[model samples]
Target chain A: MRKQHWIEVGVGAFMLFGIVALIFLALRVSGLTLDRNEPSFTLTASFSNIGGLKPRSKVTLAGVVVGRVTDIQLDTKWYEAKVTMSLEQKLEGLLSTDTSASILTAGLLGENYIGLTVGAETDVLEDGDEIRDTQSALVLEDLINKFLINSTKD
Target chain B: MIGLDSLARLGRAGLALMAALGRSGVLFFQAVWGWPSGQGVKLWMRQVHFIGVLSLIIIVVSGLFIGMVLGLQGYSILVGFGAEQALGQMVALSLVRELAPVVAALLFAGRAGSAVTAEIGLMKATEQLSSMEMIGVDPMRRIIAPRLYAGFVAMPLLTAIFAAVGILGGMLVGVDWLGVDEGSYWGTMQATVDFRADVINGMIKSVIFGLVVTWIAVFQGYDLVPTSEGISRATTKTVVYSSLAVLGLDFILTALMFGRI
Candidate 1:
């Protein structure tokens, strides 16, 4: 009975430690900020495809991340991918009415990110405004197939 | 005539083995599809509690050490090239893409996979599987399916734990030990690491590895001969085959995913 009790305790300790570790990890991944001072606004971008895109995916402009993708859904009427993004307060003035969103690759075979090409229009994009024009990512497989077909044709 | 007959018999045996493997593969898919309707969900919950919640400490401790070592080693290498700022990206990418899933799978195989083999092997030796069949209960659906589902579901969560701990470990080394700014470390990681496909690819691999490990364990255990030695052998085979399959499948997946990247 003593042996069994020790065994149970050992197992319990192992489980408790693991749970604590995982909780710590989840907190890290979520980037739970305590500051609460960082002002941010939301903007939406529509795409034909948003393959593998998820919430917390970084949003970049000119190779610098200014925000993150907060939510994604399929648009009902247009049958398109709708991605909602949150931008840092400092970047609010940078976005304009004519800003165009494009899906870009990080490396040769890296993950896809949404790149905002800030336009020169004087009208600044407000909170809740949708970026009208967007470009979807060129999937690797499609590009490879296209290359093969074109090369074969030549 | 005797030589020709022997050759024909050999060919028939080869064909039969192939047929068995094919059937096993089909059965695997059937088990997966039938999971929602079967008692698979209950088994899955038990497995998650056991494999995920239970094994959390080992995963975190191992993950933390792995991250620290990776940061130390990665920093040393990058320092040579004047690219120490790249450490965050290196650590995050490595943890998310490779170390987390593979390490989690290996550990799960040792902890839960061995238990699975032992449980099933004991049942087989005692003719419990046979008894279940006699009562019109399909052992594969009731027993094996749950284990497989549990493994498949638990792997990704375990991998997530690994990634989280690993990043924190790296952060500790980067910020506390190396004096790198926390903001810079996170900022670099966010900028350099491709989040979408890499995370998806890792999770997909975890699910596949989970399925393979569980299948191998159950298959070996259920087929164990009615002897102490046979049970031991089944346990050994389960670990060996599952590890090999995980490594082999990892290579294939890496090639398919990163080949174009």
Candidate 2:
């Protein structure tokens, strides 16, 4: 009976370890924030076409991710996709007032994300300020259509 | 007359299913009704050791192999798109979201689940269950309930083991075998997976499947006709029905939890 109790306890410990590992893997796989004290800064951008851009898409400066697309909606009056990005605190003061945002593909065939290009400006852009110089997603179909028309004219 | 006859048969089938459901519900309540005595607790612990501890090797081996396969496949495809760094994200998401819980349940149904059905079915065939009842003991509370609870408790842990080991296996194939940077593999996975949406949902799936597989195994055994042939038939049904139930429930749960997004 004492042995049985010990065995059960051992099994219980094993199970607890497995559960903890499971939670760790889940957290690691899914990019949920672990720290609450980490501050986030949200900025907005407008584009003619977001293409396949969706919420939670990575926002990158150069090749490294600085934040994520937190929300996306239609700006009914302007008739464009309005994107809101939440950047990590470390990326603060990195964006200038003249900085431009572009929707860029990760590769020739990969996920679409917003790319930040630094501009020559001493003044930094504050939160809630719009990124004025923006490039929309390049639609493949439209580009093909333009190429066909140009070839026909030639 | 033909239509009426078919309707009557359909009604009969539905009624029988309902009665079976009601019986199982009663059995479940009875099993959890009283605080377990020391002997009963001991019996349960032995069963858990068999159902969970004994099956660990198979779960680990299968998990590792499956993860390796995912790593290989994901690398081949991602390399084409020059996004091989996302291999970790792909492997982790696929395993946590679908593979681990569903595969573990299938293996459980095939291995431990089948054994349980056969054991209970044999005990019934030998009149042990009846003899116990004759001595004023409830076979359900005494015999079936402990096994049922053990299965219920063991399944989630088994699934967790499967997922965890599978992720490591992916690392083995992706990082060591394929020359993927270990930092990027782990980093990308951490950046992509969500605790509540992907991981917790997978656990919930395993929990539901645990109840389903055990319920089918115990019910099939309990309702077995008293013969050698009957025991074999019940065992077969236990495996088949449990597998089907796991797959079917997985589809429904996935649709509910992830379909819209």
Candidate 3:
């Protein structure tokens, strides 16, 4: 009986520990943030070349992450890449209408994210508003080709 | 005559393999047909204790060593390129997506799968299973079901623990010993490794491995020739077959989950 009791305790402990570990992995190890209660608003921008930008990529303002790219699609009408992002609602009226969005890489050969540069305007950007000025991602191959051509000419 | 005999032998081998697969499938359904009720819960608990709790020490020790080795290797390689901050991402992704499930399943096969096969094979060899049947208790229900269920429940949990410990071990090596920024190590990991895509997918892989390995173990044990030599052979088969099945199924599962099709 005593041995049986110990066995039960051991199983119980194992189960409990396993559950805790799973929760830890989900909350701490993975990119899942549990406290997403803070409301956010969506914004759209159009670019000529998104390069390798993917959904769930970060959107940064002044080197700090402010939003995430929620969707990326080809704008069939304009022949441009359309990117939709969600930003924290607290900064809703702070971004000017002339603010520019650019695709930037984290480091050389690293993941790509959208970076925002503030512009001089009184009107603030709101949800569903499109940023007029957008910079496309710099294509490394294109840059290399241009560099090689310029060096050869010189 | 020689050629004809060789062809006949190959055909017979193929037929026997198919028959064995069919039998294993049927036995798995039988084991999974019902819920644990009354004394069944106690039997399951005992099996869990035997299989899961006993296997914890090996899982943790191996997970830790493997993670530390990954950290060391990743640091050396990335340091050359000045990308040492990605070490945590590399270690976490590999452990969460591949190593934790595959290696843990392989170990579980060698440890618990073999033990279950041996125990059941010995019972059969000693005529204990027959005695249970003679007493009007179905040995399949009484002996096999609980063990199979215990394996199903234990494996994913064990695998989760393995991955969690492995990540911590990587942090120890990458951050403490290697002088990588502690903030960036964990921050990059948390930013990159998706819970749904990597972690949950790994859990799913372990669950499938557990089912297949346990099914193979119990089926091999129950269908043995009930001789001492047969018992030994079946035990060996359990480990060998389980490892192969885990590896093969991992490929299919990976292709299905991450293939974007």
Candidate of highest DockQ: 3
Superior by lDDT: candidate 1 or candidate 2: 2
Ranking by DockQ: 3, 2, 1
Tell me the tens digit of each residue's lDDT in model 1 across A1-154.
6754554455455445545544543334433445645789999989999866778788988888788898999999999999999998887766889999998876665567889898889989888999998999888899899999999998
Spell out the clash pairs found in candidate 3: none
Which window of 10 residues has the lowest lDDT sum in candidate 3 chain B?
Answer: B28-37
Error of 1 at A27 (Å): 9.4
TM-score, structure 2 vs. true: 0.85
The best candidate in terms of lDDT: 3
lDDT of 2 at B192: 69
Native A-B interface contacts kept, per candidate: 0.10, 0.62, 0.90
Error of 1 at B238 (Å): 1.6
Residue-level lDDT of model 1, residues B124-188, one tens digit each, is: 88999899999998787777777777777667777877887898898889778987667767766
For candidate 1, give the docking quality class from DockQ. Answer: incorrect
Query: How well does candidate 3 score on lDDT at residue B198?
Result: 90
Whole-model alpha-carbon lDDT for candidate 3: 0.94
Error in Å for residue B110 of model 3: 0.7
